[model samples]
Target: MEKFKSFLKRKDIEISAKRYLIDALGAMAQGLFCSLLIGTIINTFGTQFKIPFLTSPVAVIGGTEYTAGGIASAMSGPAMSIAIGYALKCPPLVLFSLTAAGFAANALGGAGGPLAVLFIAVISAELGKAVSKETRIDILVTPLVTVMAGILLSWLIAPPLGKAAMSVGSLIMWATELQPLLMGILVAVLTGMALTLPISSAAICAALGLTGLAGGAAVAGCCAQMVGFAVMSFKENKWGGLVSQGIGTSMLQMGNIIK
Candidate 1:
């Protein structure tokens, strides 16, 4: 019990801060690299392997919802979680904060915007770290509090903000017939550039409004491929290999699915 008590204590603040920064930066960089690599591969494949069945699946599953911002948000969780846990020796608290931040950030991003959610996550993590002490109760308390706060923030604050952003995005895309397709390609490239972002295809589809055969099919294809790629790249997952397969299969399926 005494030994356990010792574990709950915070380390030197300077050391803790340094370690936190390094871990966060490393995670962010890795996510960014993956996003760019995936984007490049998708663009190349789109041109070379234009087959509907093949590309459609990739597009549907491997769409560009996962942006760098999303990745940075996710990556920040583990770093902040562990740092708080070790520095304060309150595992539960750290874990809770991580969970809260992740959920809040993702939900916010999915609803429309990510910037506000990201800010909330960072602030929550920092606050959790400050309040935690070397105790099991503290661990639990930290995360619960953070999550609750995030949930409240997301529901009351993020939703309205996201709706407004979506409205703008919708207005921007509504101006043209081929706008959705162009938007899809642009988003796909961005997702490729930021591999850590989540399913962006849904937003694109919603924006496109299922107005025509081509637009609907395109959106569907993007969603399938994005999802498929995410599934394949669970951890340090190879983007190139999965993308190749995704492109081939998604395009092939598009022809059958579209009609």
Candidate 2:
């Protein structure tokens, strides 16, 4: 255990909640933004404006043609997994191998894909790192370990994780429908609070498939936090702060909020 801790320190692999939850998870959000969010934006823009190239079919796969945006959106899992690996400072091979694991987790996990990618990617990267440079044929061993771990985890846990996440999401949605007035406030407050934390509320929303009334409440909550921070800090931060926190993220104000 001492040796392992020493090794981790040598490799700069700090094992802490802040590292995983704040750093890696935050990076995961960027991955989500790049692949899923950006893709959704492209598709929506193309469709809404009827732009020719954006709307045009770029490629065909599995008997279906996909636009550029569709292709980008479809690769969200790989993108997110890679992002997590990058954030975790994984070795080159371990980082690359996460691509396969991410795809498997996302595909198998369905609505809970993001969460699966988060967990599986972290494990696979770490496992791969463990085997990395351990042998004369390090190139072969590292990738092999990473890919196998990712594949096995996807097969074993991805589906169940997806189901569990979706179940909670469904329950939230059902409650919102059944008691719109009360659940709305509850969801709003909770999601708003989440937005201000280091954790990714968007990832949680994506994992749980938060939509309909629940989705609206979540959006409202996010907006409230953002706007609240902007307003509260206006005297100290001024307009620049207001714009950044208001439209950007109240996350930056986390320190002040804590104080």
Best by TM-score: 2
Residue 139 of model 1, lDDT score: 50
Using lDDT as the measure, the top candidate is: 2
Task: Report model 1's TM-score to 2 decimal places.
Answer: 0.42
| CA RMSD per model (angstroms) | 13.2, 4.7
Task: In model 1, state the lDDT of residue 149.
Answer: 66
For candidate 2, lDDT tens digit of each residue in 165-222?
Answer: 6555554555566578888887887777666654345656776677788889888888
State residue 141's C-alpha deviation in candidate 2, in Å: 1.0
Candidate 1 wrong stretches, greater than 4 Å? 1-92, 104-110, 113-117, 134-137, 164-168, 175-199, 211-259
> RMSD (Cα, Å) of candidate 2?
4.7
The segments of candidate 2 whose C-alpha lies over 4 angstroms from its true place after superposition are 177-180, 183-259
Candidate 1, residues 1-259, lDDT tens digits: the string is 7653444344222334333333433332233234433444554555576744324433222464433234433343233233333433333555456555545554665534333344444445555655566456875776666677656666666666556545434533543334566755654443332222322334544655645544544555455565665455544446653554354222212212223
